[model samples]
Target: MNEEIELKELLQKNKMYQQVLDDIEIGIHVVNAEGKTIFYNKKMMEIESMEMEDVLEKNLLDVFSFAQNGYSTLLEALHKGSSIKNAKQTYYNNKGKEITTINNTFPIIDKGIQIGAVEIARDVTKYERLLRENLFKKGNTKYTFESIIGSSDKIQEVIDTSKRATRTNSSILIIGETGTGKELFAQSIHNGSNRMSKPLVSQNCAALPDSLIEGILFGTRVGAFTGAVERPGLFEQADGGTLLLDEINSMNPTLQAKLLRVIQEKTFRRIGDTKDREVDVRIIATINEDPIDAISKGRLRKDLFYRLSVVSIFIPPLKERKQDIEDLVQFFIDKYNHLFAMNVKSVSSEVWSMLLEYEWPGNVRELEHIIEGSMNLLEHEEILTYSFLPIQFRNKPQFQSERNTKKDLDEMLIQKGRNIKPLEEYMEEAETYYLKKALKHHEFNVTKAAKALGMSRQNLQYRIKKWKISKE
Candidate 1:
């Protein structure tokens, strides 16, 4: 059921409403029944490369033309008193630049009489000549929710959140350090979602250079450049499924703008083609760096970040969830033992101390690699000992993990009188309680509560992600 939004009085404020419309990212064009342009926004001007003086109050047919006798979607909607949803329109602007857009045209009905039409547009170009149905089927994902192995409260909470995310088609941004299983969670989400029947394609944004990645994403047009041929891109192949963009911050900012258009309009332009191609793929981007930091450094566009983080999932690092190390070690041992026909029971006390003390710079992937490397050397030994460890494991870490809280020093002083404990465990409980109170007081508005908490919204968000605070 659709909920009604009260905007009668708000929309009646013409100047304010007009300013809001012009500030929108998507192009908005309004025309009367006679095809005279009544409203044209700033974004529309940018999209069509026309000035406000030339477009407003002018006839739409005079400024632009549908190529090859193509009918106008907006005019058609007005005459037929209907809507043309997700329709592609190709036309030539005054500058002679071929413009292709995905338009949602709707007619305005005043007391059952057709008054005018409005068309929202986004610029897109695409080229295609390849069939990818077979490739889509062959690259189906193997991981599901069950494939993820962890039992810590933080890991379980992240799992629950990911399971809930599978019910929606919204874009997701998974943020974590390298080797934190960001792609593993992405695969699990895809396999559990309604779109599971469709292929789940993966791409490493940094795998190719900028010039080549564009061609890889949107495909190339024949004669686009030397040695260029018509071919489909990942967007075409992943249509009706999911596209997992690993290390999305590594993508060029220029291409990031193009990706934003696709998210907004569900259409994209090919590398060298003028025609726009529509697709229905869900985007899931993973970033190894802090997104706020990425935006500050201009590696990521803020607008793109906003769109991509519709459902943000932050996976805690291995050091943050050290309690799970023992369980993870056992799981990996069982896995490698089965694969290598070894009967290794468990690690020795020395090996266990080394595993728990040393900081996992490579996270879970590093742990699995360590276990696999040890399994190869285990021939007759029933128990994995320190001798089977890697060369770097000879020296144990002397430092403990960080306590990211304001009260770590104060808590340490108090803990000496009671029992010895890491400062993080005590801070986690207090921090979680205070954050919940602040959020509840603000009716769960993160922006307002974050301000009240004397922290940036991103900082508050990180804390919430770490603590797994349920706002809904």
Candidate 2:
């Protein structure tokens, strides 16, 4: 009976303990003072692609060659009886598949002396995938309620209201200035809503012609119109999903009535078809203009406005959300870093102050362009200075419409006997004028003219073809 009790205790401490390790999802392994793998779990076995018999008593470096750099670092940590957490690691298997992992290593202690070490690692492949989806996936329906990245209370209220309305299927209307990301809010509403699992189809009503818009919204029959190729409209395509009508105010009044009918009856008729099709698409419309004003201006129908105004959301302009500028700048910096394949580390404080002080009349889109242009113009520098920005922006213009004041410039040209000139002819004349000035500056040297104007030899040759100018 005593012998049986001793056997039970031994099994509980060793084999039973090993069974507990086997049950865990984390890869658990023990390494001796010499850095040989003394014991390993089933999880570790899978990671190393080795059997228990194959891995035991194997040197950590011999078993995993990629761990050579990490072995010395981990040994130092173990010698000091300290624990390392969340360390990044990568390994290549015999099949050459790269596996990324997050590691936690703790020094094993017995009798107040460091003996060896126990390491635990969790495979981060799925976590990395989720991160990628969150960052880049257009259809991702999951983001934090506060992730909309606006500081204005007006904008915050829109986010708050959207969150409250997520439990219902009420249609949303997001109003904002151009480039304010109205569709971004619409997507947030769809993702937050109960019907998140369904699709979200977007259409810019203004981008399509009136003839094509109706068929695009309602779909078409095999012979819907002259040379009518059958195609599904926004309603049918978004069935059991959400339909976003971007620039809704720009949609034709006739189509507006059809859309109102669909919203009211949840049914629509395909062009050249007698049958009405039922659909379950949630409607979200965005307009850059005020709906009340739009109705008064004959831009939108009052009845359609009332139907969409059930759940209205208004996004504030970028200037109002000034506090979010830094976060947004960082967000774009990280975004462009990967996109442009440059290692931009930071933006200078002076450049940031310049960004803050300037009134962003064009909002986030303008800021994004400024940053992108700066990245393109500058080399691989650690800091982005204000001087790196475009010359037009460095001098900075006061708040004014982006519309050309240069309409008079065209009129002036017409009055100067240039009215009948073709565009290419005008371009050729302009190029010749500039080329002559540059050549005078360079004493009519072709190489000098090319270098001074930042034009390549081949580009200069092409311009000369259009210029019809001779060096003689």
Candidate 3:
């Protein structure tokens, strides 16, 4: 009778433990030493699109055939008593819905004996979908000329020139500073071209090493090297279509020479192949710095520049297009309204004045981030006021400087019966003032603010925390 009572109490404790796991956000699954499903939480059921009745007391290999094939972390942990952390798992469920998750799996040991294995998973399907849409979707354009927000003459001229260039097959080079919407213009040109029905492939020249980039652009034949396999390169895949080369100035000189030959002859050979392969890909390259400066610095070759500059388009920085700031602000407001489910209608006059007066060194990208951050913090207000702006905007450098002039300080001191405070106190006040000013001037961007202040970013962050300064 005592044994039965103890067994019932242990079952109750296990039930309580399972209930606790179900209430948590992460998916959890526990398998016994024999690889049988012993416990599965509610979140696990939701993530896998399965039911409790289907998984309870069933062999994991029977439920997920991949387990028996030695492809599952739980099975591996069960057999090897090993732990796996942050391993990516992608699989298709019974209903044919693809699922992607990051998993941490480990063995459950009790008193020096391996009892079972448990797995914790976090879903990342949505993020993976967004990444695929951005990087690999063919014949799909996410932006066009209509999506370009500004109506300023400088932008309009570039748009017109880009549209004209799309009607031909000549090589085109785009020049602008960072955040000047280079990719946006490139995609627009691709969509507007006669080859819109074909694939539009793109690669960033600065994202990989020279060896990997060569293989990615020109492909490699089977047995080209120790581990190389036959593959189709971007030029061949984009045949009869368009290929966008972003940050072209970052390409090594040797790769640039090969690219020049491909552009001139419309043909390129695989890494280990002797015969040349023909392709009809129209090339569009982008540079975020001046071409002449790049040449002088040996980052780019003059011959390659001449070949790519058959037609060149320049995108003006946001500071030079101040007339478009108001429009761009309104556009971002509407965008966030839809994204964040807010109802912000307009900006206060003071907010507009401050926006116009500020020099947008980071250009349109920075403005978008500022508006998005402000909108995220807004609550129960229809109009965006000065208070809704970030603390950096509220404490601009010009206003702070005017408030700290010697004349104003002397008048304030005189009002205090000509009494002076301790030198330490005055020094602390000055330090606080300058730190805030530097942060505000950089719009609370830690790296840029640190660079402007001649300090490390970690040091700046420490001082900001010490001063109890709020970025929002």
Candidate 4:
């Protein structure tokens, strides 16, 4: 019978079985229910630096002190009648070299009762080494323009234009809403330029006060001012490279004039010093505001705008390119899997639909944060559910609802005009018409409408509802 032959083969455990184990790439060990070592592959014996005779009658735990934890693990698995696989850890070899390995273990059952454990260990030293050497690994400084993840036509066009702009050393100005990855494009330009190997100093013009920003942009000379310390500014630090000026629209006009001079003449004077310092730092400035409006409002200078706009790169907002949402979700999920040490593998269709429908006013940064939050809240299962998303995303208002509300207001306005009560009444009707149009254009969101109209939300809402207009 097959059972008799199988039992005989298992009981024999002869030299042929040892030969098969020795030929495997992974290490293997077989122990009795009493945790005594009965069989070990050649690789395991070599790693332990022991001869077959020495290990023959010895308990595995007593022979190898490092394997005590493994014995506990085996006992737990045997008690539960379940297999424990892929227990990852780093172990020392015979030469005392650390090697990463994954242990795949199964219980040896007899007559439906758990007995001992057989463990197969596969070395993952090279895999871990490859993960370390990856350019996209955390804190790696090798990111270039190519790291921008998008295949949309608009994004590709922006990349092409940015590449052309980087080929020259001309000053570049990137304009986009917040969270639009302006700095990513700046880094790409720097890497594509001849200054790839040189330092790319970054300065946030809006994060510091005027005096501190000036000091950081232009170095201060020691002994030239009271308690002044000598140090090179960002311009000097980025000499022969690039200096990114983030939030350039928020910078004062005085600083704008000074920056314009540096870009035009390649020279700047440190604080409390008369002599000019020569530098070859390429300028890459970003602004969330429109340059024309910024210059008109006197927050920026026209000359500086002209100087920086010679090569302009504009990053489109996320809402305009709805096609990228799916890929971005997958990318963020993969990122969070490694970051959170999770097994989460898939997302639900309902979650994807909710993502596609929501108006991402905060752009890609917001999406990334949402994904991270979702991953943190998810349990051990491999699927991401709709409930994991933010409440606002799940309940996004439909476009038809918006249009229906707009039509209601338009009909009310026309009905008032048809009455022909007085010239003042016509004026009132026209004013309400335009006000409702403004609100509708801004998604009937009083906060956004108020901001666009330069009025408070309560004031705008009072006026609209006073006219008996329904937001729905």
Against the hidden true structure, what lDDT does model 2 obtain? Answer: 0.73
Per-residue alpha-carbon lDDT of model 3 for 332-410, expressed as tens digits?
7767776677778667644655676577888899898889888978987877886778777568796455535635655
Instruction: Write candidate 1's Cα lDDT for 1-472 as tens digits.
Output: 1222346554568878898999989999999987789999999888788999888898775577543324578777876888999987766576544467899999998998888999998766332001112222345538788767665668889999999999999999999999889999999999999999997989999899997998999899998999999999999999999999999999999999999999999998887799999999999999999999999999999999999999999999987766567657766776666568777767764475566656788999999899988888889787788778765655444422222232564564466568755667766776677679779989999976754443345456656876899976
Q: Write the per-residue lDDT of candidate 2 for residues 1-472, one digit (tens) a residue.
A: 9999999899779977888889999998788876677888999877656688766897554445332112333454565778989887655454333456788889988898777998888888567535644675455445546456543445667778888877787777888888888877777778887778887899998898997888888988888778887777888878887999999999989989989999999989989999988999899999998888999999999999999989888877877666557646655765677677776755664575467657787888888888888888878785788668877787665312211322444454455654566887665554576667667767777665654443334345445664676765
Please tell me which predicted candidate would have the highest TM-score against the true structure: 4
Give the runs in model 4 whose Cα sits over 4 Å from its true position: 1-136, 395-472
TM-score of each: 0.55, 0.56, 0.56, 0.57
Residue-level error in angstroms, candidate 3, position 356: 1.4
Worst 10 residues of 4 by lDDT: 64-73
How far off is model 3, as Cα RMSD?
A: 22.3
By TM-score, highest first, what's the ranking?
Answer: 4, 3, 2, 1
Each candidate's root-mean-square deviation in Å?
26.5, 21.7, 22.3, 21.8
Off by over 4 Å in 2: 1-147, 151-154, 398-472
**After superposing candidate 1, which stretches have Cα over 4 Å from the reference?**
1-141, 396-472
Q: How many backbone clashes does candidate 4 have?
A: 1
lDDT of 4 by residue, 61-124 (tens): 3344221111334444544667887886543333333355677778899997767777777767
For lDDT, candidate 1 versus 2, the one ahead is 1
In candidate 3, list every pair of residues with a backbone clash.
none
